[model samples]
Target chain A: MPAAIETRNLTKQWGDLKAVDKLDLVVNEGECYAFLGRNGSGKSTTARMLLDFIRPTGGSSELLGGSGSDPDIRARVGYLPGDLNLPRTMTGRDAFNYFGGLRPSGESDVRDSLVERFGLDPTRPVRELSTGNRRKVGLILAFMNNPELLILDEPTSGLDPVLQEEFRDLLAERKADGATIWLTSHVMAEVARVADRVGLINEGKLVKELTFEELRHQATTEITFGFAEPVPPSAFEDVTSVAAVTQDGVDLVLSLNGPVGAVLKRAAELDAIRVETEQNDLDTIFIQLLSGEEQS
Target chain B: MSATLSVYRRWIRDRRLSTVSWTLGIVVIIVATAAFYPSLGSTTASIADGSDSGEAMSSLLGLSSGIDPSTPLGYLWISLYANIVPWTLMALGVALGTAAIASDEDTGALEYLLSGPVTRTQVAFARFAAAVSVLLLVSFLSGLSMVLSLPFFDLTESVTTTAPDGSSTTAPGATVGDIATGTFSSFAVALGLTGIAFLIGAATGRKGITLGGASAVGIGGYVLYTLSSMTSSLDFLTWLSPWRWYVDDVMLINGLTWDVTLPFITATLCLLIGWQAFLHRDLQSS
Candidate 1:
């Protein structure tokens, strides 16, 4: 079977600036792919191109083995834009019903259930809702349809902590049910927890693609050791890829990237005791990739 | 099957306030005119004299000296083409037609409707039809007001007298046939103005600009017609103005003729072009 969503060298340029440049994205079936990028890094532009909201200047995209513009493809795809601007005068229920009515075999009860679960008041006009509630309304509309493919841009930008957790669980449930999800987010922890594979994007280009296990393995490890006596430089000469080393009296804190067993073995030779190691989080990896310090 | 109709229904629901306001404004104007008709008739009769030159007087009133000011039908004729019907129709048409498309898009209601399975042409045609229906209804109400007030002025009574040329007077009573003719002329003028307003709305995608452009075209045409009548050298310019086809003197005195049909036909062509513009243009809800 083909990938759920595929784009081949998709390039979109506005005047002199390239919003999306030669992006090669492959979202597998039932896999939650997280796209990480900074502002003006072409995340939203890529999502817009995927939905055919704006045509790409060059290259092409396909949805479920069909053209992006095909009605069949659109019917199975649910999109939530970065900036959600709905009609202010309509009630939340009315807004959902309006969008739901566009599709065939739409379920009104599903919208109702989602609205209630989010604690959204259907009677209130959208204009009266706070920014977070407004975002909730947009989220409910995008997810309630149970679309075969979901593209959510900054899906948790305005939610409270509890609601954010609920949203993550909802996404987990959807993924378990075999729904392909393409999520773009700046929060590394959120992506680290949910994404099966993460792609780091910067300056409108995809820089790296890593699975969760590979990402964990490639992350830096922090090591701290208290020596029985002062350590000499020759004792640490065999260890390679030491990011930073600091000595406060007899205690040494070394940040390194390599086999943890080798670092421990080398520390034993120095008569160091009380060794501790912790892995670095995705934020460090992301920063390293963005600063051009990571190996390709 | 009923989904398209639901879209139209929602459009009408969205515009209910504006529709009611325009309808009330037109009705109030018609009622005020009906109330003041007696005073107008008496004033015109007192001023009517054989010594007044028909050419100079026609420039101001667009009426020939052949019309007897004592009769209500003659007054109705003057009012129909001179100022009352055209201005009323023009105002109603601009308000209704411009609000039809531009306001929907402005409020984001058009996006909701367009996202449905229905095609763009259906929405355009349905909206145009709805706006035209409102315009025609306003015309019918204005005509009804005039018809209802005909009896209070003793306009239904027949009176025979001699003209200035020593000929027997045959015209009498505010007849239904005469009222129907006036109504048809009003309908044509209203339709023409509405079609022009729709074209402006589709082209501009803005309410204020559409209404302003449509009103300018309408009032500017009337001014052009006046200028054409005064100077024989600029007579060809009259053909460009839709108002020239529904000139007060021509409709009220000459009755409904093929000449008036020209404006209706031109207006239909304009509406067709407007529909095409609406079909091709990309919709952006502001």
Candidate 2:
């Protein structure tokens, strides 16, 4: 498939600081690539460079096979900045009309649907709207045009959970329509659900890129096995799928790296009471991934 | 419509209320000054006579080429056109120029606007045009207000004065064409400042810096020109000041001159410099 977004050694430098170092990224068409990074880790800077808001000191980027600097290329793209700001006097409706008018596909019907979906008041001046409402306006502006590629930065920062979920649903709907999505969000669950793949960046460097399945694979499953009597932590050590094993009074907790079949077999052989399993969520995984990068 | 037009239209639409407010404010000031010309014309003329040979007062009031401050045109020039109108326009022009890009950039609004289909070039040019349009609008309305107040205030009637030696002098009344000339010259002065402010704002995207830089040009130029009139030491530096030509030409009463084109030329240079800076640099916010 053609790449929807691609960067070749994309770099941006500010005096002594390297905002975005030599980086390579490829997000294929119809793919939802979630760019994950810590705060001030250059995710937003990268996004800004990709959209030509700032020029890279080195290298270049392209969207939909064209330079991002080209207006015609940007016309086929939708973008949402991390902090959405409009003219203070502009109403939500005005933002839609003004921003939407630049592109050919800003159908009023799509705009109306988005406004309703996000539960935004169209008539209030943007200055009066709360951050979440302003974000809704930004989201609507980004999605209203139905562009071929969507570049969103911290897309759900100020949204309530309900609205965040709604936004996820909208992303899903757009993904179903084959629109390429390149987003950077701290909401790990949102990334887990919507992004087919994720790229982790550390201090301006692209550290690792992995499919959601690979990310989950890095997340070990913790299972606890209970026995009538205190159990030693070494019982599941022989099981190839168990990475680590520990004991708590009458239960044994095992961190599994693979299928639970062998651990279950071992647990059944020894357990006289109960069994429980816990999965490491992406939030923990995201932290671990970054902390690991920091360590090295 | 094209992206440039769309951006331009939105800028004008969003500023509609403020635009009306500024225009009305200018109109009220210009008209009120003209209205007072009837009651204060004689006193103002005498004041002009009192300061007639005082070089400092002449420089301050921009009395040039035998302008009698008692005349309708002279009083209007001293009261409104000389300082108030051009100063007000310059202040407003700086504001509009800063608003063109710097104000929006301060709030990250410019970055958001740039992320759309519009090119930075389109935004820079469109916003500069929009700002110029508003400045022109306020200028036209204020001039119209002065013109409308002329007949009501006896500004159309010429006045004659007699000296103790039986010598007499007559100062001509104000005319609609004079008002146009004054307003246009004042606009040109303000436009020059606006272009400077726009250039600074586009180059820096910092409101304080843009306002300060352009304001320095306007106020500093005036001060430099005024001081240079009092001494010969600063005369060489006076050439850099817009007030040098403005007060010397005093287009309000003397009619239009070739010097009027100086401000326009300065404004074009500013636009080109500012545009090049904006086109090449990274935005302040993003």
Candidate 3:
């Protein structure tokens, strides 16, 4: 596949501080790559480097297979900075007109529709708007051009839940239209819903990359089987479906991975009385990965 | 429209209120000062006649040889053009130049703007041009105010001063051309300061450093020239100050001279150097 965004050992260093360590990333055309990282973990720095806002101390990056420093290449890119700042006096409508005219694409009804979808007032100046509204303007600016690639930093930051869902739907539509997305977001659910691949960055390094399925597989839940009599921890010891087993009086608490079918069968054979399952979401998995990385 | 033009227009629009306010403030000062010309013109000239304090005052007024302070051109030069006009314009220039990149970059707006389909070079030049445009507008309006009010304030009448040694000297009435020369020279000086401010801002991308550096050059130049004029000991240091030639040339009363072109050269060089630095350096995070 043609690469929409590619970086080879990209590094940005300020003396002893490395804002973006040697990172090698490649998001193929039509792929939604979720760049997940904790705060100050080089996510925004990497995005800025990708867009050529900051010069890398080493290596290089290419956008749409062309240099980010090239204006023509950037014209095909829609970027939403984490902290979007326009002139305070500029109205939302003015921003659309000004930024929209820069691209080869015309100012289409898509912009107006996006405005309505985000529930933003086009007439009010940016200073008068709330944080969520400001974020809406940033979103509209990023999505308005229908660019080939969207590089968004904290795309849903400061957004209400409904607007965030609306933004996600917009992202889905754009993705269906063959647009490649490279975004950094703390919302794990949002990432799980849309991303094909997720890259975990920490301490200026790209720590791990995995597909959504693989990430979901790492998401483990706790299942406890209650019984009329005491069950030894060894009851489910040999079961691969149960990652960890512990005895709590007459109950068996199992760290469950994948399906609970095998455990259910084992519990039935053992004449288990009740089965209660506690589900784990992606947020736990992400936190575990980051904390694990920090410990190491 | 081209992105450069669009960016330029947007910058201009953003500063429209500020530019208008600066122009109006300057025009008011010019008219207000001119209003006093009819009342205090001769008295000021008589006070400057051969006293030690008078020579110091002449130096302060930027008076040239044989130019009586009582004459219309001399009076306007001493009262407004020499100090107030150029210094204020220079201050404005410094502010505009800093605003061109440093202020916006400081607020992070410049970074957002650069995220568009515009090159750093385009934005740099667009902003600098906008800053210069505003400075020129203010300078032009100031000169126009002085010229239009010249007749109402009796500054259009030629003055003859008789020397104590029985000799008489006649100085020409202030002309519109003289007003143009004075305004353009003041604008030029301010342009040089503007360039310095732009260069500092571009190279450093910090507002405090840019403002401080440019202001130091301006205020330091004045102090250097003033001290140099007072004593021969500081005369060698005078060459370092742009005011040396500016005050010595007294373009308003002495008419146009080679000194008027130096600031233009300074401005172009600063712009070129600053633009190159801006293109090469990383933007400071807001």
Candidate 4:
């Protein structure tokens, strides 16, 4: 089957600034893809283009195998805008009901389930809800309809830790049921936990695309070994490219990039005991990628 | 089609309280004016009777009271046109109609609505229909007030008499039916103004600017028409104003002519243009 969401060289320009530039993305069915980017990095712009909220200036996008602004395409897609400003006069329950009524085959208990799961107060007016509560309401509205494709921008924002974990699980369940999810976030840990494949965007361009396993391989490992005797600076030569090494008396800390076997052999040759190795998380990989450092 | 109608129903539910308040406010103004100016009827009668004093007063009040005081239908016509109809009704219509669409967009609720299965045409038409309904309701209620009060003034009686040239005078009572027809003329005028305001709101996407700019142009047109009517040098300018076609005294006392058709036609054209603009413009997120 065709990809659930595809953009062909999609470009959006606001005056001289290119908000999104010639972005070509294909999100496959039943896969959870995370778009990782820093502030002003075109993630939100890309999401908006996918949803047809704003017309692309130089290229085109398709949602659910249909071209721009197609009604059938929109019917199968659910979107949560980066800026969620609901009407202040309406209650959270009313807003959800209004959107729910628009769906052709919406679940009857979706709203109630969401309200109960999130512990959201249905009686409170939207204006009275806190920012986090408002974000919860927006999440419920976007996810409750069980749309075929879900495009969420910064989905976990303003949510507490507990709700964030619940949201991640909900996304996983949706993916298991053959739904496509296109998520954008600056939170690397969350992206690492949920995203099967990740794309890093910078200055309106997709700079890197890697699967979770590839990302783990590219990450560095921390090695700490206590030497029986003081070792020379060249004692670990030809073992690995150490990013940083700090020695406190006899215990030595080394941040190394490469196979763990190399580091282990080098430590054994140095007569070191009690050596520990821990893999670097997604946060380290993100910082290294965005900072113009290549991962070998 | 059902979805389109649902949007209109939603709009009515959202704005019912505000509509009632606006209509009530306009009705209060009309009633107060009618109560304070009871001689307004006598002045209309004198002008209809064609007496010298009646003629002077009719000129001063900018009215034409027909040919006989005993049958003062002309005065009733003047009251309906000038005081009861267009002035208050049209202002309310423009304010309420412009707010109906532009306010939703301004506050970002429009995106939520448009993102649904409803098309842009459905939204535009539904909003237009709802606004027009509110305008008609206000006009009808105000007209009803005037109709119910006619018997209190004993102005519902018909009479017959002998003329100076031996001709018989058969004058008819100013029935509720006549009053309704007269009110409808003003309704047509107000409807046109409401359409113009709706067009402005759609084009600009700003409720305040649309309401303010339309109100200025509307009130300015009325002022220009009144000023031009008083001056021989500016008489030609009166034809350019929308208010010229809606003048209460002229429509009620002199009766509407082919000249009144221009405003209604212009209004329909403007509404079509507005709908087209709404359909093509990108939905604003606001």
Candidate 5:
């Protein structure tokens, strides 16, 4: 079977600035792929290209094994843009009826369930809704059709913590039902909860691609080893999984990835007097990765 | 329903309030103008009966060769139906056309709409149809109000004509059909002007440009025609203005002419060009 979403050398340029550049990406069927990037890192641009909202300056993209511009193919895909704006006078119910009427197969029960899940008031006009409520409306519309693929950008942006949790649960449920979700987010916690694989984009280029397992085993530990005799930080340089080492007096701090077996053996060889290890969370590691503070 | 039809229905529903208000507003203007017919009828009749004064007044009021301001058709044309009614409709038309694509795009609502199963082509055509439909509805209501008030204004009496060739004749007064045809002319002219706005909106997706451009064209056309009516040197430029074709024949008194078809043709051409431009250009998302 073909990938749910695929791009080959996909590039978009506005004059000299490349919004998205030679991005070769694939989201396999039933996979939850998190596109991690900072603001203006081409995440929304890529999503727009996939939806055919803007044409790629070079190369192409496909959604559900068909051209993104094809209406029939778009029908099977649900999209939540970075910014959601609805007609001001339209009530939530009005939007549901109007957009639902356009669907090839109308499913009112599903729409209702989503509304209920999100605690959305169907009678309120869009203009009267708060930012979070507007996001709820956007989410409900995106999930109403039970689409095969969901492309969401900053999906949980305005939601409270409680609603964010609910959104994660809803995403998990959709993933369990074999839906392919491609979401772009700068929030590390949210991505950690739902992402099976993550591709980090920086300045319109894919910098790193890591699976959940790889992320779990990423360079996240900072080890502090002290010795009676002063030792250089390079003493542990040859050790596997050691990302970076910093020396202070007779003490050295090492950022490690794998088990501490090799580091311990080396420590014993160096007759280390004291040793301490602190496990770092994914966010810290992600920051270090982005800041180029961690050694390759 | 298809996405195109659904969009059309939603658009109509959204504009329902504005439609009612514009239609009612035009009605009020018609009623207020018609109330003057009772008092102004005799004064206008004397003017029509006096050849020299009538010639100067006809030219000033944009009246045709055979039209006499004393008659119901002539009074309505010079006083309300010709300039006031069409200009009011023109305001509504420019507004509707500007909002059709450009305003929605400016608000970012259009991006959300297109994200659905609807295509850009569907949106372009559906929005144009919806705007045009509202123009027609408002125009029809305006015409109906004029027709209904004819009896109250005592304008159903037959008219007497004085020819420059030393002859006189009598013709039936303005009928409901004449009022309907007159309103149709206004609708057509407004539609043509609105079509220009719609085309600009579709091509540029800028509300300000659409409104300003269409208004400039409408007002500019009228100015050109008026100036051309006085100066023969600028008369050729009147062809560029639908106002020329509109008031030249005085459809309410002279009945429908081939000139009435000009607005429809212009509107169709503008719509086609707008649609093609919209399809090719990138949507200006906010």
Candidate 6:
């Protein structure tokens, strides 16, 4: 079987800027691939190109073994844009019916069930809804088709903690049911929960690709030590455990991936005022990647 | 149901308020204007006798030949149907056509719609067709208002025409055929402008450009036609204006002419070019 999503040298250029530059990616069938990128990193642009909303300047992309412009292929895919804007007069139910009616036997039962699950008021016009509620409507529309593939941009952006958890659970269920999902998100924790693999993109280029196991096994720790006097970040540079260091006022925050004992001993020897340690997860790795720090 | 048809239905449903308001407003204008026909009586004929100011007034109002202002059809032409009704219908068309693609695209709603199982071709055709249908409906209502008031205005009376050479002739008064054909010609002119708006909207996907550009072209065309009518040196420019095809013969009084088909032909050409441009261009992000 062909990969659910594939791209070869997919690029988009606007005058002097390359929004997506020579990107090559593939998501196998039933795989949950998360694209991690910062704001204006071309993640949304890639999603738009994949759906044929914006034509790529060069190279190509395929969705579900067919071109993005193919209506037949599109019918089997569910998409949610990052910024969801509906007509002001259309109620949630009206939107559901309008978009759903376009598909061949669009899943109404699924739509209704998802609406109930998300606690969406289908009777209310979308313009009156809050940002989070509008996101709920977008989510319901994406999941309504029971599609074979899903392309979601910032899927859980405005959801509260409880609803975010519900969304993650729903995503896991969909994954287990053998659907391929490709999503872009700034929320590292959400990606850590549901993503099987992740690719980090920076300035329109893929910087790193890591599996869930590799990401989890990072096991990096953040240690913050306050000195009586200001200390430079280079003070603990030779320690094998120290991956990166940043100074905040009189405090030195060290990212330790190996063993923290050596760094702790050194800090103690230096007569630090206070030393605090916390486990640093995927978010730390993301920041490190974007900030030009070398990964261990 | 066909996807194109479904889109058409949805678009029409989306603009139901606009269609209702324009259609009702036109009907009211036509009725109110027709009510004055009885009171004006012979004064209408005196204006058509062509005094220096009267001729200038007729030209400015787009009351050209084949219309005798003494009769009901000619009265409506000089009073409201010729310029007012057509311009109002054209305004509706321009508004609808501009919103058809550009408004949806700018609002970010069209991107979501395209994500469905529909194609860009379907969207383009559906929107254009829906705008045309609503325009025709407005024109139909305008004609119906005049037809319903025909008996009230005693429009069945024959019109006596006095030629420039001092020759007199009699012409039959307004009939249902005249009303139907006149409405069709009016609709054709509006549709032509609507098509231009659709083309601009599809090509650019910007509401401001679509509305402003289409209005400029329409108003410019009218200005050119009016100036050409007054100056023989600029008369050739009339061929390019829908106003010429519309008012040159004054359809309600003169009966139908071959010029009625020109707008549809031009509109189809615009649609083809626009549909292709829209299908290939990148959708503007909201």
| Stretch of 10 with least lDDT, candidate 2 chain A | A263-272
Q: Would you list the clashing residue pairs of candidate 3?
A: none
Clashing residue pairs in candidate 2 (N, C-alpha, C atoms within 3 angstroms): B45-B70
Tell me how far the alpha carbon of residue A241 in candidate 6 is from the true structure, in angstroms, after superposition: 1.8
Q: Positional deviation of B51 in candidate 5, in angstroms?
A: 12
Q: How close is candidate 3 at the interface, in terms of C-alpha RMSD after superposing the true interface residues?
A: 0.8
Candidate 3 per-residue lDDT over residues B150-269, each given as its tens digit: 999988988886778999977788999999999998998899999999999999999999999999999998888887767889889888788888888888876889888888888888
DockQ scores of the candidates: 0.17, 0.77, 0.72, 0.28, 0.60, 0.76
Q: By the TM-score metric, which is better: model 2 or model 5?
A: 2
Cα lDDT, all candidates: 0.73, 0.89, 0.88, 0.74, 0.86, 0.87
Highest DockQ scorer? 2
- Over the stretch B1-286, how does candidate 6's per-residue lDDT look in tens digits? 8789988998888788878898889888888877887787568777775764544467766556835677777787788767888899889989988978998998899899998889999999999999888888888888888889777877766778678999998766678788888788888888899999999999999999999999998999888887776678888877888887787778876778888889899889989999999999999999
Ranking by lDDT: 2, 3, 6, 5, 4, 1
* TM-scores of the models, in the order given: 0.74, 0.94, 0.94, 0.81, 0.88, 0.92
How much of the true A–B contact set does each candidate keep? 0.11, 0.87, 0.73, 0.25, 0.64, 0.71
Instruction: Tell me the interface RMSD of every candidate, in Å.
Output: 4.2, 0.8, 0.8, 2.3, 1.1, 0.9
The backbone clash count of each candidate, in order, is: 1, 1, 0, 6, 0, 0
lDDT of 4 by residue, A1-296 (tens): 57988888999888999988899998888888999999889998787667655678988888778854665677677777665666556788877766777667567597688889899998888778998898888888888888888888898888899999988888888888889999999878986777889999988988889898898888887888888887765666555577677776677778887556776777888889677777778787788888873232
Chain B TM-score of every predicted model: 0.86, 0.96, 0.95, 0.80, 0.92, 0.93
lDDT (10s digit) by residue, model 3, range A127-147 = 688899999999999989888
| Candidate 1 lDDT for residue A273 | 72
- The window of 10 residues in a row where model 2 chain B has the poorest summed lDDT is B47-56
**Candidate 1 CAPRI assessment class:** incorrect
RMSD of each: 5.8, 2.3, 2.4, 5.4, 4.1, 2.9
DockQ for candidate 5, C-alpha atoms: 0.60
